[model samples]
Target: MSRVAPQGVLKSRRFRDYLFMTVGILITAWGLDAFLIPNKLVAGGVSGLSTVLYYTLQDKGLTVPVGVMMLAMNLVLLVVAVSFKGWRYGAKTIYGMVALSVAVDGLAPFTPHLASHDPLLAVLYGGVVTGIGMGLVFKARGNTGGTDIVAQLLADRSNFGVGQMMLAADASVTLVAALKFGPDLALYGAVAVVIMGRVIDLVQEGLSVEKVAYIISEHSDRIADAILHELGRGATGLSSRGMYSGEAREMIFTVVSRRELDALKALVHAVDPGAFMIISDIHEALGEGFKENGV
Candidate 1:
């Protein structure tokens, strides 16, 4: 009975994971079809190379759509991923790559020039849509499975980090674009890639950035009360021995949003004018009243 239950649980979890993966792939397809492809702005990884190749061939009257090229390129990269990174990593990437490829191809017929001639607007919208798609994939613990697999393999074998390896791969595509197209379009592509990457990081994490606040005050109880009553936040009290004075002290440890920092500081000041305080950014926070679990 116990073994059967475990198997059943595993199957359920796999089903849920597949659902999330499908959603991520669909969002990626929408971004490419609705924004990125329309703009001709290449982002980083295998998709970027596909964009470059699509335009290069289009000029010669032998056009291959970005989605088709992306599928082919990812298929090639999947071989390398399996050969170098072992079957586990390859297996993880294969489904996502195939799904994204199929989705992209399915979405290909609907691509229209939404941004027209406005390069800046194209870049902005393309970056945002691409970022959201990438964010969803990352949040699902799946890869777009482009050059990301190559990046990982290289990072494991070389001294470079994943980011550096990915940047190098994308830069190679941008260089190819510069040689085939003009430097201006290549530069715009680079900017679009950078913006998309940053936006992905921001979205995958949450909009409201967290900050850790430390407070040392004489009126610790009063400050804690204010934080609870006014701010509806929680705090932890720590007993500390002051290094400078060799005196006992009570410190408050709390986490708040960036917007709440000023209010927290004011509260500390109001309670104890001579309070010592420090604040630092917290990249991720998860709990009740904050970003929920698994998000």
Candidate 2:
């Protein structure tokens, strides 16, 4: 029974991942066909390349669907991805890219142009929608398998980071867009890229503005008590020895929301004016008072 339960759980998790990938791909397709493609906003990746080719070929009297071009390009990239990263890496990516390609083309005819006359609106909405979709796909441990695969391969062979590599690859596409589509549209594409990146991060990590604070003070107990009572937050005391002072001290570590930061600071100062505090941003906080067991 125990073994069966574990297998069931594993199957459930996998199903969830595939479901996320499917929905993510569909949302991404809608965003591209409705907003980005109609407005000619080439925000990078295989989609951007497809947009450029679609228009260029259109000018040459060839009308190829953007989704078809994307799928073709992704197929070539997927071969490279599998050659280097192995078949295990290709599974989810294959599904993600193929589904996305089909979805984009399938919905293109029915999807309305959301921002046909407003370039700024197109960038904003398209970026948010696509970013959200991509983020969900990533969270499900799936890859879209275009420039992402290229960027990963480049990063493995070079000292540059994956982000830097992705930037370079995507930037090249934008540069091509600049030459083919003109500077104004290319600039909007850049803005869409920035917005998409930001939204993706928010989707993956959440928009929780949690701050981690390390407080060092003589009155650690007092400050901790205040945090527990006044702020309704928990704090831990860590034994530390100051390198410069050669004195053993207790440091207070606490996590609080951004809204409580000022109050925390004030409470700490009121307890010990000479206390040292180091505050940093935390993407997410789970367990206990924060998110309650990563829910």
Candidate 3:
């Protein structure tokens, strides 16, 4: 059977996407100003390049806003993104990139710099925040232009995907930053990169525990239907064997958010009190109800 969404649901989802991207831009800029910039840590991407150039020019009696540089560079890369990727891809990416550019500069002056002197703290916190912002962008099925666009372009012509391509491009930038800053700072920047990568995965996948429930009972259909209707989640029935009982069984499999676990339990119990039920942790759930497809 096919599930068709109502038009209102589609519109709501679109609005949610825009909100997520908007908040993501704000949070990412906050991270850049509050931690990365103060500590001179570049976590890679176009923003990282802008940070590096911004400081270099500053010492040479030139002052350019990091956000300005980012927008300029992103526009150059945006051309390539539109050329290689479709207009849909380019448009979504443009939203992210343009908003990010505005947010970084607009918020920088108001956002506080580091309060502590520890570079490690800056690296850890800054990376987490930036990663979170990027994760939100990914959740909206969008990408920020610049190296992300470049990565997609290269991935189009190469066997590697975006992650690897991003790493390669970021490495060149990191090396350049190291030359400008020093080996120690460079090492710290590398650590920030690693942390950022992990946090991106964490945010994209979610840090909270999700549950997958397996239920076996004569009333499996009743329980599954209850789950779907009450929870707004889909469930699948799979064939299974009970080796001890020498009987075939139909099992219901469903994934639910942690908050919905209790409701799911109640629904299952009400329908089939004797049902053999098992629930286990799911690290991540990606689909209609959970995470959207990422970049």
Candidate 4:
């Protein structure tokens, strides 16, 4: 297990985390108010169920706010988290969940019903806004305190990864939505979940999607130099023996942006026309010329 940092250091780390959490909360609230609530659209998690129930009751002439239902469902999930994961895990989640609930309720009055009849537009916009919010929360290492905690715990105890577990859990909810709201709404909800998950991954990875280039060439030095000078990126040479040739060779390794990828290939081709190079996508790049530490 990873050790917890000291209280002071942890507090410093939490400053940015809290800021992101607030941003996430606001975004989620907007999504609920502007899209999901107005259109009676159900998403994937507890929020989805809350939306479903809100509309169901409203159809029967009862008026219960979705925000209230969201809070109640999250509180119930918090209890489950405490029982299964203990107080330490539950503490952070409780804070985040409560804060989000309060923000949702507070923003409720300000959010006007704009597109109550357009389900497609509601799903599109709601999914995007909610996805952004979910991404922010994930970047802060905080769960939305929905079925996410349960999914994570199940994943840890089972053979599945967290992502897989989340998919399974959300799938069950989606199935219920399909039974209740028909296939179209369920399909849209599934799309929303997938989009939301992908956006979360992208945001957590940050803006580091550089391309890693591996060059096996005779003119390794020239290629390396070109990468350094032209691409403004660093290259490292690794000594390796070719299995087929049984001779030692210097392999050049470097990372460059997707935009600079063509330039890098051109540089490599210019330096050594016959150089063997492998290029792969890098989801993130950090340090030195890239995203600096503490920035």
Candidate 5:
């Protein structure tokens, strides 16, 4: 598992990662420029602060591109990240940051403004798109610079969850934005962040949310095989015993998507009417038919 690739191959893979990160940056920039910027709605994080500053400066007749501000802020955090976290930690971050900064600036020129009358609709659209872009960057093993670096470092040194740390940082930025953008805008930003948060989960986990099925039946083998052949999903058989009856039996475990739920249930019931089954939601079902390797 701890193997290093050849230098040439490593460089090639690095380039590919950079390419994907660039696409993510471009998509993120388009979302911001088109939906969020036009409607004065913001999500949390470095991008959110940049949006606030962009409009703040706009009011002062000074034109500072949001991307440029983002780059500057990220550079400050990048330096701090490297100073404490080490060079290797910041290397990919630097590459991602620079590429994202440039892509955001470059793509802004071409991105169309949605100019939607409803601020809520714009927030939803922008949040989802930006979340997708961020998810792609994460999938490529790239960083988004700014507070992500700081949050990651902090999360690593403590028992806190990374998501929680990130949320704290993002909420702080939105709070600051509120002081300048007004209370209502702040609330709108929060709503946007909520939407974006969910979208990021969906993108990273794959949209095909699954349901895990646990079966306890007399003929567990038959049900498991049916699930495997009919549903194209793997099933595990476990040794289980009846608590009250003092009899041993086999239990089956399988995961399938929402569309396959009815079929899976039907299959188990058809095989054994007395089959006991449990189903639960799977937030992220990676591997196999889920997210592809290296993505």
Candidate 6:
């Protein structure tokens, strides 16, 4: 009975992951067909390469489907994913790639095209929509096998990092786009890529601005107490040795939202005017007082 319950919960979570991945793929496909494809905004991915190839073939009187090209490209990349990350990661990537490719093509016929055909609007809106979809897929711990595999492989083989490798790949794609589609449209595509990157970060991290403050004060107990009572936040005191002074010290540490920063500072000041404080940004703070676990 106990084993059965755990198995059921595991299955439920897996089902939810698949559901979110599917929906996110569909949304991404819609954004591509409706806005990006129509305007030739190749935002540098396997999808971007597929877009460029789709048009190039069209000009050559070949009516190859963009999704087919993407699927073919992604299938080749899947080998790298499997080899590097193993079957667990490869399985999700395979599913994501196939689903996204099929969705992009399947939805194209019924998907309404952007009537205005404005390049700028297409880039802006398409980037946001596509980014949101990608973010959802990422949140579900899924990814479409594309340049990601290549980037990972390159990072492992070389000293350059994954981010740098990904950037290089995207830049190469953008350069190809410029040569094929003209400088103006390529520039728009590049802008779309940048916008998409920002939107993805926004979706993943959210807008919450949590600040972490470290206070070095002689009156550590008073400052810690003030932080707890006035700020309504927990504070920790760490014992440290001041290397420069060869003296023992207590450092106060606390995390609070941006809104409470001024109040925290005021409290710290009142407790110890001579206190040295270092404030920094926290990308995320998950736990008791902040966001709940698994949220």
Model 6, CA-based lDDT: 0.89
Candidate 3 lDDT at 161 equals 95
lDDT of each: 0.79, 0.92, 0.85, 0.80, 0.83, 0.89
Looking at candidate 2, the ten consecutive residues that score lowest on lDDT are 1-10
RMSD of each: 3.4, 2.2, 6.2, 3.9, 3.7, 2.4
Candidate 6, superposed: residue stretches over 4 Å from native: 1-4, 80-88, 115-117
lDDT of 2 by residue, 205-227 (tens): 88869999999999999999999
lDDT of 1 by residue, 1-295 (tens): 4365878877887777677778867877877777666666666678777877787788899977677787788878777777765687644467888788788878777666567588777777777777777777777677867767778888999999998998898898888877766787778778888888888788777665788988888889899999998888999999998988999988999998888888998888888899989898877888876877652
Itemize residue pairs with steric clashes in candidate 1: none
Clashes of each: 0, 0, 0, 2, 0, 0
What TM-score does candidate 1 get on C-alpha atoms? Answer: 0.85
- What clash pairs does model 2 have? none
Best by TM-score: 2
Evaluated at residue 1, the lDDT of candidate 3 is 100
| Model 4 ranges off by over 4 Å | 1-9, 207-209
Candidate 2 Cα misplacement greater than 4 A, ranges:
1-4, 241-244
Summarize candidate 5's per-residue lDDT along 32-113 as a digit string, tens digits.
8889876777688888888889989999999998889989999898787778867866467887778777777887878777
TM-score of each candidate structure, all chains considered together: 0.85, 0.92, 0.72, 0.88, 0.84, 0.92
Residue 126 in model 4: shift from native, Å? 1.2
Clashing pairs in 6: none
Cα lDDT, model 5, residue 259: 90
Q: Choose 3 or 4, whichever is better by TM-score.
A: 4
The list of candidate 5 runs beyond 4 A from truth reads 1-12, 156-159, 225-234, 242-247, 256-260, 283-295
lDDT order, best first, reads: 2, 6, 3, 5, 4, 1
